[model samples]
Target: MTAAHRKIIHIDMDAFYASVEQLDFPELRNKPLAVGGSEIRGVISAASYEARKFGVRSAMSGKLAIKKCPELIFVKPRFDRYKEVSQQIRAIFLEYTDLVEPLSLDEAFLDVTINKKNLKSATNIAEEIRRKIFETTGLTASAGISVNKFLAKIASDYNKPNGQKTIRPEEIIPFLDALEIKRFFGVGKKTCEKMYHLGIFTGSDLRMKSIDFLEEHFGNSGLHFYQLARGISNSPVVPNRLPKSIGAERTFTENFTSIIPLQDKLKDVCEEVSIRLQKRNLSGKTLTLKIKYSDFTLQTKSTTLPYYISSYDLLLDTALDLLANSDLKTSVRLIGIQISNLNINQKKAEYVQLKFRF
Candidate 1:
């Protein structure tokens, strides 16, 4: 089938963390609420719609958020509860089709072209999913429907906070041309600035640039830009994509010069990785130590063990051994440890495949 014949839907929960807090607390509903750390160094993980009206936003400092909205009530994040809710929502998606690709705990892409219920309209499926999510979880989800993932993701944001938008195949070209360049996916601050200087401020301006001009300026990504400007993206909706490796890293506020300090930091990083491995019930045979020098130079050392190891002590020791053998030429700005060649059992692998298959 052609891309235009496919049916895709992107669903995003509105103010997920903050909304959960409000739902549980009752009194916080319709009030300015934020879920995050309340310490001086704490950051806002999510802000309720009421708080957003006052210029409060996620990733802003807690202090700044409070200053912006004095009535903002801060609540600690409940990741466990969030995970439970995520699973509940995932189960709802599964009831329709196995083409559910979760982007995070609160958002996912669903290809309902050939759903279990044999739904003909993706828009109808999106509406039904939103209704089910609200009925099951007491939270609102905004949805976007389109022929492909990119347009669906963008359309999902068009009407948000308990809303839905659909971009028909006939509407793709006009919709894209009216969009700002910054609204295109992967156009970060730096890239937006570059595009602005290159006279590509909107999708219309972007379409005017020849492939050669874009390639000369943006390199390989120019091809993506060229296609996106013409409202063409064929990326598939992949579900249950597992991690190839598990790792953790930390950047030091103060660069470490001594091996002792570096070893201490490595222990912390390894512990973090161990926690993740345990959470995912995973282990690996290869251990890699990544180092970033004070001068921003990067180095990595890796060694493969005979058996998989998930213990914190073993990973720390292996990482330290690798670090010790490597030449210490400069102070370290960042340190990380990763475990690759993961030991995935046949049962788990089969489970992942079955869960993802349509």
Candidate 2:
């Protein structure tokens, strides 16, 4: 790998859903909590640290989670409120550098090799970002600083939840050697079992395996494993954190006809759009309604509002108005609503200056 002076930090919030629940409900503090569907068929979306200690985890069935931690408190998700906090935390990251890449509501990668503050050490930059996040959001985030994406991502997960780890270039080999096989990125349950059968149990064990041997066993994804084993990650920090358009659609168990039936389906679409818009912290100026006919033909009509809109009522009203303007044409099979003309993405001037001369 070519030498680089770049600094990248990966930050992940600790159990975002469960943390939010604790923040709102004082009773849930230090208790076992899982966030997701509260129903029998629902799965846990997030589990608090206390819940995790008892083997309860996100994506586990709520029933199974309760079996593990009999005292588990299940909470429904509040995406709108989560989005509000996401925006606040994001605002803090931007204070250091504009080259931030959000992976999800609770995680992001920031390239601060060249930042607004002209910080000399990436470690200090990470500390400041951590401090600012806690100050603004009342939540703690874990940070990992490294020269490349692979090391940085792994480092971030090392300490976790209100902690930070910095892996210097000189320490890369020792860090990789010390990690367990399961700790490697892209290696999950099934893969770990497979690796065990092949006598690959840790980073040192993986490094001794041949690249062609790995590819032969795991196919294309094996190439990623080979690079990760050597602590080589060339992925660039993508700076485009903007929505292309605000839209939502769904497939029904059965098709319907007429305005009344169609309106029922439209509600689901509008709700989805509102959730997406809130998550992206965006508003729209135009609403478009899409209709699909029984014959598989599709049509869409849109209307532009005079002002920017983020309110659920305004977005829903515009979508319904657009639907009312269109005819069934062919016994509508599906309907959807979309909002468009999104705001600019993250103020483009925030990107760090690339290092090498072209």
Q: Which ten residues in a row have the lowest lDDT in candidate 2?
A: 348-357
TM-scores for candidates 1 onward, in order: 0.80, 0.70
Residue 106 of model 2, lDDT score: 92
Q: Which has the greatest TM-score? A: 1
RMSD of 2: 10.6
Pairs with backbone N, CA or C atoms under 3 Å apart (clashes), candidate 1: none
Clash numbers, per candidate? 0, 0
Cα-based lDDT at residue 16, candidate 2: 85
Per-model lDDT: 0.87, 0.80
Candidate 2 has an lDDT of 0.80
Best by lDDT: 1
Q: lDDT tens string, model 1, 249-298?
A: 87676778888989888879999999999899888889999998866689
